[model samples]
Target chain A: MTDRSDHSRATWRQSLQGWLWVAPALLFLVIFVYGPALTNIRFSLFSFSAMSLDWDFVGLNNYLRLWSDPKFTTALTNNAVYAVISVTCQVGIALVLAAVLEARIFPDFSANLFRTALFLPSILPVVVVGLVWQLLLTPTTGLIDQILWETGLASWSRAWLGEPDTAIFAVIFVSQWQWTGYIMALFMVAIRAVPRDLYEAMEIDGASGVQQFWHITVPGVRETILIVTIITILGSLKVFDIVWVMTAGGPNHSSEVLGTMMYRAAFRDDMIGYSSTIATVIFFIALTIGLVQIKLQKDR
Target chain B: MATARSFPALAVLNRVILWAVFLTLAVICVYPMIWLFLNAFKTTNDMFAATWGLPKIWHWENFSTAWNYGISRYLLNSLVVTTATVVVELSLATMAAYALVVLNFRAKAAIYTLILGGAILPPEVSLIPLFRVMAETGLYNTYFALILPNVAFGLPFTTFLIRAYMTGIPGELREAALMDGAGEARIFREVYLPLCRPILASAGLISAMRVWNEFIFALTFVESESVKTVTIGVMSFAVALRADWGVLMAGLALSILPILATFLVMQRQFVGGLTSGAVK
Candidate 1:
């Protein structure tokens, strides 16, 4: 009885030590992450500027304004479009490439070189990517347009980033170009981890290559697909840098996302309450999606 | 026998088509960066006229002009911020992960979840409050303003990553250390820290890359020219010189070169580190 009591005492002391180590990080998260998240709600209720503390409590007026505001609606709509298009294209291309690479479709191809080239853009600074794409898509002297004209496809060479209809799509294509490799890398590792014996067993049972892929490979990486889709969705929801630097959500705000819209509201337009409301909306959207992802993973 | 004979020809055609697709994708991915590089060496006229060709003369002056336009200062500021963020993030995460993974605590699961909660909470949600907090505390434009949020935001993922790795370390080793009368700090310092170098490097590299390339926070927090990081600096530079493609390309190249060089040298670690945490 004494020994068990002593062990319990020791465990309590060890727990105290453990919490001590976690205290500093917890403090930081409280101050920066959790605190700010909660405070965002408080800030959303008040009308104020950047630094001024004096403000009026406006209740749900800011959020109500969001419904009436055309820019906010456009930003929300554009974000939805960006999310749908980017997730489909990026995840779709990555799935194909990962499966192909895992299957070793071209045995002679340099996997290392291909991976390096593809991933290069993922790591490049968003500013650089925006600048480079801006140059390439410039109508008069841009390399893309120049090449299109030279190849007798001049009609296809109108300003890619200038027009409203094509601007968001253009941004989404740039996004796919930057991120597909990253998603592909994740999927490649997941597919490779699928057991080799399963494939061999299926082959012996007279399953064709396509049949084997559909039966074994697709289901094998389904969880990774889900996780990657969640990541891609969250990424598009918070995507500001690409849209900000590419077009500044311009050509009549055709490409504005929630992130950029939030920035413009608070900093550029002095709508702190409205900005915080937008921030709150973003938080709930992310939280709901994140919860769904977690629940799905748990169910699996 | 006839089926076997025809299969080889079909496989050969399959290989041909696959190679063509792969090569085309590779070219599409690589051609723009190469064009950017080639354009950096050309004058404005050459950049316009000889879009596909190599530069007649490498205009090294573009780099000098970019450097003089405060690119060097922006690079230094970014380096300092990135280093500080990495150090703080790794150290705090290491301690926290060690506690969560190695220590026997009842609320450890809840604590872990709380920390990981930061990962999903988009920075957009926190930006205004953080901005207000910084302004109130008089840290709005300081390096700490940027470093504080960077470290805080980076901590959850880094802690998650390090804890995942530390869990794989044999508990017997930690048990032995405890038996020898080693304290928690000592066990962490002497036993876990050394074993943790690889994972630390992984977390550190990934977080460092993120901090180095981050734009939104830097843009929102720091307003002074002296404190501006590379991404925002390069953006302003690009905006300022919209028509001067030579200087703009050179500035963009300069901004990217350091990270690209580091990535090349540590490509294996970067790839492994980035994809390591994403996997279940």
Candidate 2:
């Protein structure tokens, strides 16, 4: 009886020790991730300015203000546009690239070379990517314009990152260039995981390449597609580095998104409370997508 | 699987098309960096006049100018911050992951779910509150401001990665260690840590790259020239020398060199680490 009692006590002590081991990490999560996220909710509800300690509870005024603010609207619209375009182009191109590469159309060495070359851009620092493109797209003396004029396509060449009409698109294009390869690599992992036997069975049934892709490959990687889509959407919504570097959300805020807008409001415009509102919006959107991804994953 | 036995003509045409598309993509990915590299070695006049040509003169002065201006200082700051972050993050994450995987505890699921939340926690959402907290704590504009939050943010993903890898370690190896009168710490140190080296390398590489390349937090938290990281340094450098293309390019190139080298050397680990995250 004494031995049993001692054993139970020892087990309890071990359990406590286990928790103790994880305590440090949990402390960081609570302090940095969870604590601030919850605090942001309160900050969003208050009326406060940057660098000011005084605060008045404003209820939902900041949220209300977001509805009518033109800049906020543009930022939100731009984020949505970014999400849509990034999902379609990045994921779609990745799927195509992965499917082609997996089909082994190229010899082994060539395929490896192709992947390395494409993925090189994804690893480059976002700032460098921005600076290189900025130089390439400089209005008159840039290489892009020089090439266009030499090729007799001068009419097609305007300031790519200059005009409001083209600035956002140009930013989006650069993003696609940077990320498509990384996303392609992700899909390659998924595609490679599909059982080769399934494809062989379909091939034996006289299924064409297109038919095999739809029947076997698509279903095989459906879960990855959903996860990748959610990731892409969340990423696009929170995008900052690229936009900030490339255009500073600029040529008159044409390329402004939620992140840069929030930065400007908080830092430049001294609207801390309102910026928290934007951050809150981003958080909720990302959370919703994440939850949806979890649900879909669970169902699968 | 056997290669597709198709009509020769169709196969030939397919190969031709694939080669064209692949070559175009390769050029698109590679040409810009080469162009930048070439331009970095040219005089401003040469950069403008013969934009696509090889350098007439290999101007080593561009690098000297960039380094003297601010890149060297910023690089040192970045190195300090990134190294501290990686060290702190790896240690914390390893302990946490080990506890979660090797021990039987009641709140394991809840703790895991909470840590997973960090995977999606937008850093922007925490910016305002973190800024105020740092300022109040007198950590503002210090390396700790960057390092602490980076460590905090890094813990979740690293813990997740290490935990996953730990769980895959065979149970018998641990059981035998325990039967041999080994303490938990000894078993963990002797048995598991060595086994975890590959995944640790992967996680370490990923964390290093993130802390090294991070911009937003660095941009907001540290404003002084002395504390500014490479990302901010390069931004300010470009703005300060808006038309000095040679120096700007050199600064940009310098900022990328360490990360590029790390990536090339640890390509397998980096890709493996990234795919591990995806698997979650």
Candidate 3:
């Protein structure tokens, strides 16, 4: 009985020691992340601004205001459009590119060269990307317009960023240009792990190269596809820097996303409480995507 | 594999088509960067006059001009913030992961779950409250404002990666260390940490990259020129030098080149770290 009591005491000592190591990280996370996240939800219900410390509680009204806010709806719609286009281009085309690379159609040196070039943009700061693209898409003197003129397609060149109809699409295209290669690299890693024997067997059975890709490569990298898709979707929903730098959600808010809309309302408009409402909605959307990820992983 | 070669003409056509596609895509990927570099050397007139040619006079002064225009300050600020953030994040995460993985503990699962849950809390959602928190705490316009939140948000992923790595370490090493009368802390610092060097490097690199490139936090929390990171600095520089394309391009190049150079040098580690963390 005495020995048993001593062992229990020792275990308790060890547990306390473990807690000591974890405490610092936990403290920071709770204070800066989880704690502030909860406070943000509370902030959404109140009427406040940068000028005042007081938060006057006006429950549900901020949310009610969001329903009638045209900018909010436009932001939501733009984010949805961003997600769809991102998934289609970043995931779909990237997977195909990765599959081709993995198919051994080219020398290893050449393939790596292409991959390194493609991924160069992904490592750049989004600010740089946005700024660079903004310059490139400038009306008359930009490289893009210059190329169009050189190719006798000068009629197609317009103020891409200035047009309400084209601004969001232009921003989305730049995102794809920077990101698709990174996604392809991820897919390449997964595709390389797929058993080579499967391809050899398909070849023995007289399957075409395209047939082998569909039957073998696609299903083999299923989990990666799902993960990359979720990442792309969440990234699209939370995108701000590129849009803010390129358009500032301008051309009459045509390029407005939830992130930019929230920024403008809080900082520019000083509608802190109303902006928190938008932030809360962003949080829920992320939460929903995360839950869907969990569910899909479980289903697998 | 033999099927394609069975039809010699078809095989040649396929190869040619694939090569064409690859070369075209590569050009699209690389041309913009080449154009940026080319334009950085030209005068404003030269830039517009010859959009696709080499500069008539190499304007090396553009970089110096950009450096004087707050790019230097931004670079210094970004370096300080990124270093502080990565150091704190890695230290805290490594300790937490060691405890959760190696120590005999109660509530380990619960603690792990709570920490990992922070990963999905989008920064956008917490911006307003975080801004207010920074302001009230007097951390606003200081490095702490940026470092604190970056470390907080980075903890989840760093800890997750470290924990996954630590779990793979042999238990016998810890047992042997214990047999030698080493304390838990000693075992962590001596036995496990040396073994975890590869993963530690990976986590550090990934965190450094994220913190260096972070924008919204820098934009929101920092109000003064002294504290602004490169991402924010470049934004203001872009506005201030909008008409000076040569110097603006130089500034943009300066902002990106360091990270790009580092990436090129450590390509394998960067790719391995990114893919390994995601795939598992």
Candidate maximizing lDDT? 3
Off by over 4 Å in 1: A1-12, A51-53, B1-9
Worst ten in a row by lDDT for model 1 chain A = A1-10
Worst 10 residues of 1 chain B by lDDT: B1-10
Worst 10 residues of 3 chain A by lDDT: A1-10
List each candidate's DockQ score. Answer: 0.54, 0.51, 0.57
* B98-192 per-residue lDDT for model 2 (tens digits): 88777776566778788877888779989999998988899999999999999998888899889888878887888888889998889888998
| Model 2 misplaced stretches (Cα beyond 4 Å) | A1-12, B1-7, B265-269
Ranking of predictions according to TM-score: 3, 1, 2
The A-chain TM-scores of all the candidates are 0.93, 0.93, 0.94
RMSD of each: 3.2, 3.4, 3.2
Docking class of 3: medium
Residue clash pairs of candidate 1:
none
**lDDT of residue B158 for candidate 3:** 97
**Top candidate by TM-score:** 3
